[model samples]
Target: TQLLEQSPQFLSIQEGENLTVYCNSSSVFSSLQWYRQEPGEGPVLLVTVVTGGEVKKLKRLTFQFGDARKDSSLHITAAQPGDTGLYLCAGGFGSYQLTFGKGTKLSVIP
Candidate 1:
């Protein structure tokens, strides 16, 4: 199984600031997914990138997959306090094996 490594283990920013978090791995993944978890809830899927060089945008957030399918990133524009959460990146290997990163804990101050 390939392991995903996330950068900037923790981030604290003021409202309306823009920031980006990255997920990287040495091995290529068939597919990669990004999730967001709140204080006491399960992680929620934000976007899944199956194709290399693909980009998806959700509202003020942008998701991108590396051309080699070995990395990914999430960028938040004009971030708000509600955006505070733990950002996780998962790499899909075989049938259902998923390797997750340690996640970046983001604290958006209002």
Candidate 2:
């Protein structure tokens, strides 16, 4: 069975702190997507890195796809209260069903 395992499922940090979340799997993936969700709202796509060793940055956030395409990473710099949310990683092709990670809940305090 395809599965994505995420680490440090819960995180709380003060404003201006840095944090990193990880997604790992034994199966190789074609692509992976990162999403952030708030209460009462669906997850919003943060980024998708298809190629191996690819890295994309959004503001203070950075996403990296593993060389084997079976793992990924997210790093946030100078986190703010607005960053508090649930972070999810999905692995698979868009045309196919994606397997989601357990999710990481982040809380950024002011």
Candidate 3:
């Protein structure tokens, strides 16, 4: 089974800090999706990039898909307390089930 692996399983930062989270895999995917999940709530979609080397930005967060489609990265510029959550990256297509990384939990303290 294919899977996504995330680095730095946990992170703690004060408000207005910057951080980067990584996701990796051995298989290529047609598309990739990034989601941010809060405690006791379903993950909310942040962005979906279909093409390799695609980059998308939301507010202070930037997401990039590796040119090989085997990895991705999330870079946050000047993160705020609201950015604290579980950052998840998922890749797959159809109903085959979306594979999610172990997740990077970010805590931005005020």
Candidate 4:
């Protein structure tokens, strides 16, 4: 099974600061997806990277897939309090189930 490990399980920052979080796995995957979950809601899909070394940006957020497709990173620029949530990374290996990371909890203080 491919297990994704996330760094700095918890993060706290003041609003307008920038932060970067990472997800890594020892096994390679066919595709990787990033998600964010709020208090009482299911995770919302943020982005999906299928090609190695692919980079995608969503406003102030940027995502990149590793060259070998075994890792990914998310960077938030000038973060706001609304950006607080649990970030998760899931890897697909052509199976019905996806291997998911434990997630990184973030709190942006206003």
Q: What ranges in model 2 sit over 4 Å off?
A: 93-95
Q: After superposition, how far is residue 88 of candidate 3 from its true place, in Å?
A: 0.7
lDDT of 2 at 32: 95
TM-score of 4: 0.96
Give the higher-lDDT candidate: 3 or 4. Answer: 4
lDDT of 4 by residue, 27-50 (tens): 888899999999999999999999
Query: Each candidate: what lDDT?
Result: 0.95, 0.94, 0.90, 0.94
Better of 1 and 4 by TM-score: 1
lDDT of 3 by residue, 1-110 (tens): 68789988999998988999999989887788999999999999999887899999988999999999899999999989999999999987554657888899999999
Compose the digit string of candidate 2's lDDT tens values, residues 24-107.
Answer: 989888899999999999999999889999999999999999999989999999999999999999998446878889899999
Candidate 3 displacement at residue 78 in angstroms: 0.4
lDDT of 1 by residue, 27-80 (tens): 988899999999899999999989999999999999999999999999999999
Q: Candidates' TM-scores?
A: 0.97, 0.96, 0.94, 0.96
- Whichever of 2 and 3 has more lDDT, that candidate is 2
Model 4's lDDT to the true fold?
0.94
Pairs with steric clashes in candidate 1: none
> Worst 10-residue stretch by lDDT in candidate 2?
93-102
